[model samples]
Target: NVYADSIEWMSRHLNHRENVILSLHPHNDRGTAVAAAELGYMAGADRIEGCLFGNGERTGNVDLVALGVNLFTQGIDPQIDFSDIDQVKRTAEYCNQLPVPERSPWAGDLVFTAFSGSHQDAIKKGFEAMDARAAAEGVSVDELEWAVPYLPIDPKDLGRSYEAVIRVNSQSGKGGVAYLLKTDHAIDLPRRLQIEFSGVVQSTTDAEGGEVTSDQIWAIFTDEYLPSQVADERWGRFELLGTRTSSDMTGDVELHARLRDGDDVEDTTGHGNGPIAAFLEIVRGRGFDISLYDYVEHTLSAGGDAQAAAYVELQIDGERLWGVGIDGDISTASLKAIVSGVNRAIRTRQLESRLAAV
Candidate 1:
């Protein structure tokens, strides 16, 4: 109130002739320099002076970056260019030898990153919809209105890519992992797969006690699902040879499967209400105790020729596991998911046995 009153008094009495320009230079003695500067501007001050990153004695001076960006976000031009804020932060840190907090507004490492599941999901979907709309309208991304979740300003406007916007940690969720994979590797995972992968990421990060990088996540994905048919001798327990499904007018479905299990090849026939059920019955008849709990499928890419992705969750002996598969055919993808799930379950049991021995 005193600062505003002083500014008002000066503007009214000292600058009555309109021959003088009032300026404000506020300190951080009370840690309100930025507020003082903003108020001074509104109170008719023509100019305000502050140091970068609030680097001064005591609490230092007001943070010009914060003040300026505050104005920029309000659709007001602060007449300052902060398009490359990371560079600005680097320069400041180098010259001052003072580290900036990771949560610093607009200039920190994790400022643009989201860890919560809901936030990550909203942000991911928001960016996707924005891009689709921009492409449909034949306009640049900048021309589109900015309304991303949990982000006040577009990071790209500051020369930052979306790669770092969603990082995975123990507290992260399915959407964050999916966003990272999609942005970094162009692999768009289905929703169920995202959930499945999030569990893997959480476990890895929990064990490592830190953030999981994109490369590590990709390695896990490949190791879990992309085993070679011929090179993976351990996976010879079940190799899909061929499958045929027939549906009659009464809605009855019959499935015939030829499977090679460890040098013992055999043909099996089963009847169920659906293809997956029939396949499960065949496996059950072979002495495997597996039950399907959940299933989800989606197209990985756009257009008619896009690839499909499927995710399956199975309960095997009271333990649950998830699997993912991708292919040009939806049915094939689902079957692949089943195979992946069984393989993962087997691996889990082996790991448990080893740990118990240890």
Candidate 2:
């Protein structure tokens, strides 16, 4: 209130020439610099001046990035584009030697991200609605209403996305994420999976407001690929606890596994040419018939401590689905891969159902 009033008074008394410019520069001593600057602008101030990302002495100056994106969310095309927020953050951090907080609005790492099952479900449904609406209206999702749960504005509006940012802008997208997984972690994502997972990488990149590191990418891969205990509920509650495999003289492998989805535990036995085959046989007996479409395996490193990564493509419900597993034992990796494939398919179906309900 005082700052805006003072600006009005100053403009009236201090101007001797018509060329004099009235610019409002507010410091964030009380965390009201942005509000003060806005008020001063309404009070006939020609412009507002502040540091990028609010970097300055004491409590910091007004964040010009925040101002820009704030206007962007309100259907205003701000003069400045903070869409490539990470690039802006990098430049601001470089020039000002100050780090933007991870929780900062429009530019924070977690501000636009949706984590947990419920939040993910809501966002998924929102995206589906957005896509459908965009298609029906024959408009880009960016040009239409942006009401995706948790995410305020499309990163496209800000000029950053997986495909756009990764290759041309040096950021994460589906192809880049898949390449990183294959090269660094030995995870060769299928073509469909690349498309599906790119959405994830896109959101993560947007959430992180920076380059998604290899380690972060690996973490996302494992979390999304692994079979959760909740999966066995819809497809017979049997979470694999432990496994035992033995071969007979006839070249058939007898596999036994301790399966527990809840507090109850049971043992299952199946016979086939290998552990993976026997594992699928066990699942087949449970009414979920799955056939191996393709299988690939590789070692993560050399020598003793190396871990094996297995990629199992299974034909389920006329869809070619993929699963991945990593373990010290190749057989175990194969078995886990089979299980992961089923779990991944179930999760995909669950998302579809959620979208349908929406």
Candidate 3:
């Protein structure tokens, strides 16, 4: 509704042009505040009003930063400058001013980054193309890189430094090497090196089965600088059980795991159907039927020592539960995931039982 339409509207008497910078303040009280704000934008409002990070009254208001970026991506330049969004974000955190979770879209740690090999490959290709475009156009690479895929807008446009573009951790991919190298050493490893190094990293991390650090990568790279095919470093062991190898090499392997859990006696061998499956089977066999519903796995570290973590949703017929597990071994991680799911199931069932008794 136009501000002029209000019963006591007086601003309408003043000159307000059609090309106006309209702002929206959405309250979470009704949850439609953001939607209403977007509606205003759609109705040709030039500017949207919002708090720096959506810090406002109960449930907060619209996140202006997110909205601004979204507008920028849509080719509508947000005239309001927030070139140093990162600094602003940090300040917001340092002041204990807000509770912005890392999972928040556009501003989260994991938003632009990917872990799966396929996703990494795609992002790498996208940046490569963007780089090529800038080279061909003779424009600043900063200008060209803005249109790269996955990224809504050029991070630089919002004053974000390249340092935060990609973070290499256990869950990272070969692209991570390029990301880190570009940021840390101002050197971009050629494609061949990235490919060769990924396998090295995977093997080194998987075998050692521990956290791999930047220093370790540099040491390994210096020690064994091979054009291709370096011998396996044999960092850790993956114990296989149950499934027999079909001559073709494409079959599911049932995984049962013996994991190091704290001190000696607490060490246990959980089971699951798949990796987690066999792990669950082992646990159920031990008289603990951890009812599980959902499980999600993601790589944690970048190159070597990438830890796989599993979050399992569980609910017993009459109880409630929650469980989580992590390990270098994907299968072992799956086992932990199942345990988590089972625990959640127990919790749910228990909740139901209590409700029924009441």
Candidate 4:
């Protein structure tokens, strides 16, 4: 039930037939803004005003994208082309200098994804059927596809690009890897590779005990398949060593790693696709569930294994988090980063739990 005594008072004062643009700034501190907004919308309020990312001084305001998306989903024309939501999100992030977390409500990287094997299987079948139907009708697959098992709404409806669909790393199971391999390399890895890669990912994640991101998945893949070469322009070095070692059926391994920054040395092991993958796996084994939402690295000095700094965003129980790692070895730097990310996740979870108990 909505408590709209304040809004009711304002509604009584307004001209009954006036086309009012409802301007609402809700503080999530009480978790009642959304209900209030919904009541107002149903009460015939037009042109609702809200903050872009729910950002403000206190517990934030109503999320405009959320309100707009709701309207679009309800068959009401929101006066915006939501078909390219990815582009819209990009513009917002750039204009506001904001980072969209991996687990944000509508725009997060993992928002439309599924991790469980059963859910992935269902989504895969749904996409396949959507493709077949669209082909039979001679229409665009985009038009036929609905938000399947994992996604709430068609990503295309929000203008998301196909390129944003991600796979790899540990959190991803078979379906994600299949999508990535087909999209990027034009070569579908065998079921064995899928299982092997899943194990590589799972072991790493279980060790860290948290979520992983697409960019980090790519970094792990680079270390596994192309160790001598960097994963991407951003990655520094591709190497993994285990203070404590374990192996998978594919002969990939995880290692416990110790990294040093100046006089401060952080001991955190991580897993990878192979031994490098194992490094991250071992870290996951230590109880960190880190996922790399996005990362950026820049060379600070001359060539020949120059120093690289890594930035990563992590999600734990729906809250977004970030961490940084800097070193000469890009792989180590990334791993150390994610370790810092796990620390943040743990800290956040602890604080949240303490607050809840109070």
Candidate 5:
């Protein structure tokens, strides 16, 4: 209010001045320097002078970066080049020897990140929709109106990528995990599989009591779902050799599979309503009790050789688990998903036995 009254008095006194610049120099004594500067501008001040990042005597001057970015977000051009804010922040930190707060407005490390479940979901959907709209309109993403949830301005506008926009910790949910996988690895998980994997991520983060990086998340995913390496022997008990399917005139599907259990190899066949059902019958005949609870599949890319990803949820004994598989063929991907699930179930049993022994 004092700044406003001063600006009003100055404007009235300088009415007849031919060449005078009414400037504002606000201090941070009350932590209202930015507000005073803006209000002074509205009250007919022609110029604003402040230190960068609010660094000055007392509480420091108004932050020019924050003030300019705030105006830019409101569709007003502040005529400042802040596209590479990281560079600006680095230079400021080096010269001033003061660390920027992680939660500082518009310029902090965690400013654009969302850790909550609902916020992650909304941001994930918003990015997907925005990309789709840009593709449909045949324009660059920057040309479109920025309307993502929880983000006042697009990170790309500030020379930042979406990689760090949604980080996962114990507080995160399924959507955050799915968003990370999709953005980093081009693996779009099914909703149910996301829910299943969120539990795994939660346990990992809880045990570690920290943020889980993308590499660690990928390792966990591969350990649970993908084909194991030489170090992982617990899941290679049963290896699939080949598979063929046929349908009779009565529409009964018969599936033939060549399998290897340890050093022994055999060919087995079963009949049911579909390939999955027939395969389950064959596995049932081999003394493993498994039931398929849910299934989802999608193409991994938009090209001719694009891979297909399949997710399978299985119930073994009383435990429920999910597995993922990727291949060039959709059918093969689905079959591999089932095999992955069976291996995971076997691994779970082995772990359980070890715990019981201990």
Candidate 6:
């Protein structure tokens, strides 16, 4: 700050001098070199001296990347393109044989990240608002103003997806966990379900005393919602090998399916008003106390050849559970969903029996 005052006074007196080029060079010894440089620039400094990533002796120099990005965020073209910040950081590190710090200004790994519960919630809401605005205005989110809580600029501008912005730690809450699930897996949870699953995630993180990655979150989600057999074996006990269905003019539906349960296989037929109903009837006839409580089919994406996702809620022997399935064919996906729910209930009952015996 003292140097800043001196620079301003000298620049004012030397402004009218012929052929005078005023330059300001600040070091990071006080850890305010970047701030001092900015202030000196505003006070009439002609040039700043620094290196990439602030790499220098005695706690590094004024970071040029930080300065350029600072100018970029303020809508000023610093004539330096940090569009590929990772490449720049890598080059700097390779040339200097010194790695950049993880918290180095805008180029840091978590410069735009928010790990706190409230911060994550605010960032999530901010993204939603930005998306809504982009949609209403007929533009990409990148085209709109880059504003999100705890993040000064979009990491995308720096060639970073940074989906890990809301890192999941033991202190994280539902919003942060839910955000990662949707961002990474395209699986959006209902508010109630989000709260419930957040408890599971909290317990896991607390026991581990570490951060949970997005992939781990997805694994937990599948373990909780998909068929236990499928979760492990990739095919459940009640696997739908094949199916043939026909509808008559009288509005009656008949479905014949080759179903497998462990080592046994059977070709069974059932009749109902619809194919799904007929399939459920066949499953019922197999001596499984299962009934479809609710079925929801949602689009995963708007792309052609995209697989359909089915959510099946089944009421089995007075208890209910949810299962999910995905396939190219809607019918197969829906039936797999039923089988998934059935397999899940069967697995739960088996576990209970084993526990009772123990």
How much does each candidate deviate from the true structure in C-alpha RMSD?
3.7, 14.1, 16.6, 17.1, 2.6, 4.6
Query: CA shift at 52, candidate 6, in angstroms?
Result: 2.4
Ranking by lDDT: 5, 1, 6, 2, 4, 3
Candidate 2 lDDT score at position 150? 64
lDDT for predicted candidate 5 compared with the true structure:
0.86
Model 4, position 295, has a per-residue lDDT of 59
Residue-level lDDT of model 2, residues 299-332, one tens digit each, is: 8888998898888879876667777777888888
In order, the Cα lDDT scores of the candidates are 0.82, 0.73, 0.56, 0.59, 0.86, 0.81
Could you tell which candidate, 1 or 4, scores higher by TM-score? 1
Tens digits of per-residue lDDT for model 5, 122-157: 999998989999999999877999999999899987
lDDT of 1 by residue, 224-281 (tens): 7754646645552566667889999878779898877668888988788888888888
Compute the lDDT of residue 292 as modeled in candidate 2: 92
By how many angstroms RMSD does model 3 differ from the true structure? Answer: 16.6
Model 1, which residues run further than 4 Å from truth?
A: 15-17, 56-58, 88-102, 116-118, 125-142, 185-196, 225-230, 233-237, 241-274, 303-305, 317-320, 350-358
Candidate 5 Cα misplacement greater than 4 A, ranges: 1-20, 138-140, 230-236, 350-358
> Which is the leading candidate under lDDT?
5
TM-score of each: 0.81, 0.47, 0.48, 0.49, 0.89, 0.72
Per-residue error (Å), model 1, residue 269: 4.1
Between 1 and 4, whose lDDT is larger? 1
For 2-32, candidate 4 gives per-residue lDDT tens digits of 4455666666678753666555556667866
lDDT of 1 at 147: 81
Clashes of 5: 0
Answer with 1 or 3, whichever has the higher TM-score.
Answer: 1
